[model samples]
Target: MDFRPVLHILMRIVLITAVSLLMCVPVALIYHEPVSPFLYTSLIATILAACAYGGRGKQELTTFKRREAYLSVTLSWLIVSLIGALPYLFSGAIPGITDAFFESVSGFTTTGSSILTDIESLPKSVLFWRSMTHWVGGLGIIVLVVIIMPSLNIGSYNLFTLESSFQEKIHPKIRSVGRRLLYIYLSLTFIETFFLLLGGMNLFESLCHSFGTVATGGFSPKNTSIGDYSPYIQYVITIFMLLAGTNFVVHYYAVKGQFRKIKQNEELRFYYKVTFVAGIAITAILFFQTDRSLETAFRESFFQVASIITCTGFATADYLLWPSVGWVIIFFLMFFGGSTGSTAGGIKMARHLVALKNVKHHFRILNAPNAIIPLRINSKPVSAQDNNGILTFILWYFMLFLGGSLLMAWLGSDVPTSLSSVATAMGGIGPGLGSVGPASNFAHLSDSSKYVLCGMMLLGRLEIYTMVMLFNPWFWKN
Candidate 1:
């Protein structure tokens, strides 16, 4: 089974997780909050780091197979999430291990759903750490390790493919690709922070929201999410959220002055089309269904649409309280997240594009039973295997969604809450329609339910296969 290589890579991932958790210590120190939580956590992490360090030199990791790569990535996420819960546990912000793990899972999965009811009451350091989880998780912790440390260069592409399900390949070298994506990610974050500062937010608030925005994460420092911010601030966040939802490869193209490539991207075009159509439809609903002014209607509708479609989960309005039609529109948008290669979570636009193209192909096949039909995307023919894989993924996504929803219902939520909660959690979009709506939080749910959502969040973030493949008995035998 090549267990040594798997353990070796797993330990390195653990060390990276430890180091990133330690990064939060400075924030704790700066705020004069109880540093004991971070200090204790860091101490434990350092011990693990030392163990990982010692174990590495015993066996050289020259290459890793797909089996080892999958196991390492899955175990790494689970281990990091477990360790991330330490601060909340030690500081007593969220005392229960289940709740703490749930929150940490939500953060690292970039699922904005929160178990903390009083968000603003927590220490600033805790809040910063919470937001930092989102940013680290946005691109993935493994990808970061591969880029910064050249020592683990062997089989890095396998790890990269295991972590990132996105389609576009930015660079031939995995490390160069990682660097380019990281650069775009960092630049977008800084720009959002700058624009937010101009919108009158303090440095801390601006930085936190920027982290949330560029990562397509929704952990706002304010309890009201983005609703508490000004119109200008909301508009700026909306723009950045759109940018965050875009495929990083498109951003790479823009950086290199290749406008034609960016313009011709089918997924990019589909993303904008869906966003604009849904945004306009919801805006009209708000315009006529309520007394909100035109400006208010457009801003709030566009912001929420962008938030959900990108799976960002930042809410400028209580979408549940909107008209029935409005809520329905927002709910459907939850399934169609941003483009492939984007940080946003959902059935990516690329998959949807594939599904739609396949549907068209099928209809044409009915017209000519003997004719050969090739599924094409962006003017290129797609392999039947790729098309079938897309369909299979989408099928798995819905099956998980239904199963989770029923589980949530059996765990004591009503139909609306259960359905929306599972949908939101599985979509990695925060705030569903009923009890866990934008105005509400997930704190009221049973511990078991929270744990269920946490698992679903991780499943969605890893996009089903990486985590699900672990459960197959044959996966281990190989």
Candidate 2:
């Protein structure tokens, strides 16, 4: 396989990351903090990217083979995270490479997990940069490459497909789809920020939380997270988080006055059903079991459920403090994440929906030996390839969850901590139960455990196969 195209794409991604890093400089300057971190990293990234390109462009490679796509996409994220760690290291925000890499991976993966114990103590610029990682990493580094850097247009389609969620393209032109995705993303950020500011948040807090919410990323500027904010602010965040967790393709259709398509989407319908049911169940439990007022219980219940299911990881309460039933409900939601083609990360509701339907069809076929039954989704018959792919993905996901939990337990974590942390890390959902719950952080874990969790985060974000396929001899041979 040709390596130049991959290197060229990597350099462009690094350059974009460098530009994003520079955005934090103004925040640093405004807060009267050290700007050297941003300045130095940006300079180095720019130089490296410039040298990689050597001021030349190759217009011939717009589309590439599947193997090249996998390699480029994986390297893009790994390289971006490597560079993303530079600022944290330079600023002394995270004192070691492992911790910095962990935080950087969590940030880029939109996993709200953090190693920082005292989040409120970080400099304003550093905190802003952290949230910015969520925003940049939210829409995806590959999507940004396809949109902003025209020189890499040769293999842009491959990169776009590798990065996008599992949904049909919204536009005929891949570039148009990328552009629309960016527009919807930006519009949502602005709207959320505006409402948050109106709800008594200052500009910085508003922008930071807005970035976190719209990306379905759970990073917050305050130590208490959304709990520290007003009910109004929390409500606004909850609504936006729900929106972010829905498929962006659905949002694209809604923007063009195509409500019918949105309504007909099977994964979306299942997503809403799951969210409402989970929210209501938790709300009833909180209201009946706890002394929280009706409205308070309902709001907090809905907020936490949305946070977990969307894989956003934001917390409005210490859910561990809730009764046993609440814990069970939360853990159950861990397996069913937001819809596919959404910012939220988990197993994805689409795969679950399809797998369940396929199982039902299997029973029907067994009952009627010669029946010509077919699995269908949203009135369309599912392909055998898709059916097999979803089934395999689900199997691998559970196997990993089991293995990861066992590994965490062996590392000395408590049973609850081990199980939930494994679930959270693999699902890209921040905050697990027991020790790593919402009120806690991951700082106490050993370096070895942190490294393992980092690997899990990458696997979760890439949906397991892209990274796992790298280890297969046939994958490389192809």
Overall lDDT per candidate, in order of appearance:
0.80, 0.81
Assess every candidate by TM-score: 0.92, 0.93
lDDT of 2 by residue, 1-478 (tens): 7666666777777887898888998999899999999899889888878876873347223554556656777887788788889888999988899999989888888888998999989999999989988898887832633332223222222122222332234223666767788899999999999999899999999989988887777999999999988899889999999998887767877898878777678888888889999889888999999999999999999999999999899998999999999988999888887866667888888888887898799899999989898888777676676677778888999999999888988998889988888889888788998899999999999888888888888888877876887789998886
lDDT of 1: 0.80
Residue 26 in model 2: lDDT: 91
What is the C-alpha RMSD, rounded to one decimal, of candidate 1? 3.9
What is the RMSD of candidate 2? 3.8
Ten contiguous residues with the weakest lDDT in model 2: 154-163
Candidate 1: residue 164 lDDT (0-100): 33
lDDT for 198 (candidate 1): 94
lDDT by residue for model 1 over 1-478, one digit each (tens)?
6666666766766666667767777777778877778778867867876776665555544465667666776776787788889999999899999999988888888888998888999999889888887887886832523332223222221222222333234234665777777888899999999999998999888988988888788998898888877999999999999998887767877898978777767888889999999888888998998999999999999999999998889887898789999999988998998876678889888888888888888899999999988887666677766666678889999999999999999999999999999888888888898888999999999988998999999888777887898899987886
- Residue 427 C-alpha lDDT in model 1: 84
